[model samples]
Target: MSDIPLEHVHREPDSDTGNAVFVLHGRGADEQDLLPVADRLPGDRHIVSFRAPDRLRGGYTWYDLDLSGGGLESSQPDPDGFRRSLDMVAESIDAAVDAYDLDSDSLGLLGFSQGAITSLSLVLERPDTFAWVAAHHGYLAESHADRSPDGIEGKPVFVAAGAADQIIPASRSEAAAEGMREAGADVTFGTFEGGHGIGPDELEAVQAFVEEHD
Candidate 1:
């Protein structure tokens, strides 16, 4: 869909494993930001992180945010840019699978902040693309989040957030978990003691979740 593919950084596993995880970093972050997180995962997973389509600050953005109406927690994603990134992300996953000879059925999704929002929407929009998902500190998109009728039945989703988070409050993540559950996802919502970032306990829980699915 996009003429110029999203810029990305990819790491291959030591073995010939076809399993892979598509990582998406937060707003104002690059593809490289989440590569280190992948090291905490298993050695057999191929980690690929994609740069957002637009440049913002010193990093990248999946879409513009509208905070005019309320606080940061109430900010909504600009629909046009939001939907555009969704398409690009889908394309990128397809390209990655073909380019690296990865297994489509063994795909996983990992994302944070705006990237988390994108990942959440994708699993709803294209449920079959990923086997599991991990979304940290983000909420469901406010617009154009169309879940297919059949829905993501039995899909495994891990949503972690800070209980004291002001950026995208814990309540928002709770609602996200509810949303995914309503769509038949096997959701595991993890809450850490801190605010707006993952903690060691949260990381361990996330790692365990991934390990279970992998």
Candidate 2:
């Protein structure tokens, strides 16, 4: 576990409901980046947006990526950094729950790109931590494939990817969906018509998915 403190933005619902959603930003983005999307979610839930721990350029990253080789095969994710971020996220969630008197059973997670990778990792590593998860334009890290054999049989998962995403190919997204299914999660996977970013249609689908499980 890491000793680093997590930076976050918390939005309380109008009615002060105990439910909460943890929103994670993509690479080069901060905690505030996903606040709008969290606001648009279909619920009276509290929103907590967390910042990545690692500083990269002017923004932040959950883990360092090594693309020294050629293709995705040569790319390497920093395992140590990833683990630290995971710990930080866990700590943040606990703190949020306590501070807001939130319902642990109603907790959900949403992430984009690098944030999505970390979110999925958290769900896989701690299957009972989240009620539902939405991973956008992300993949399961190769390093975490052998952690545990325990399956998330009843967990609900939504995965959205762009068919023309240049940064993360559709193949990676498909493989991620397959992996989640193999882990026994009830997975809802979809591919959009655009590039490496989220669109209105994708957000609508995610809203519906979350509502279904909420």
Per-candidate TM-score against the hidden true structure: 0.94, 0.93
The top-ranked prediction according to lDDT is 1
The digit string of per-residue lDDT tens for model 1 on 153-196 reads 98999999898998889888888888888778999997899997
Query: Every model's Cα RMSD, please?
Result: 2.0, 2.5
* Model 1's TM-score against the true structure: 0.94
lDDT of residue 25 for candidate 1: 94
Superposed Cα RMSD, model 2: 2.5
Q: What is the lDDT of residue 202 in candidate 2?
A: 89
Question: Which parts of model 2 have CA positions greater than 4 angstroms off?
Answer: 1-4, 72-74, 146-151
Prediction-by-prediction clash tally: 0, 0
lDDT tens readout by residue for model 2, 1-214:
1232588887888995888999899888898888877888897998888899878778888888867657653355677888888888898888778877889999999999998888888999888879999999998888765544465886899998998998888777778888888888899999998988888998899989988999
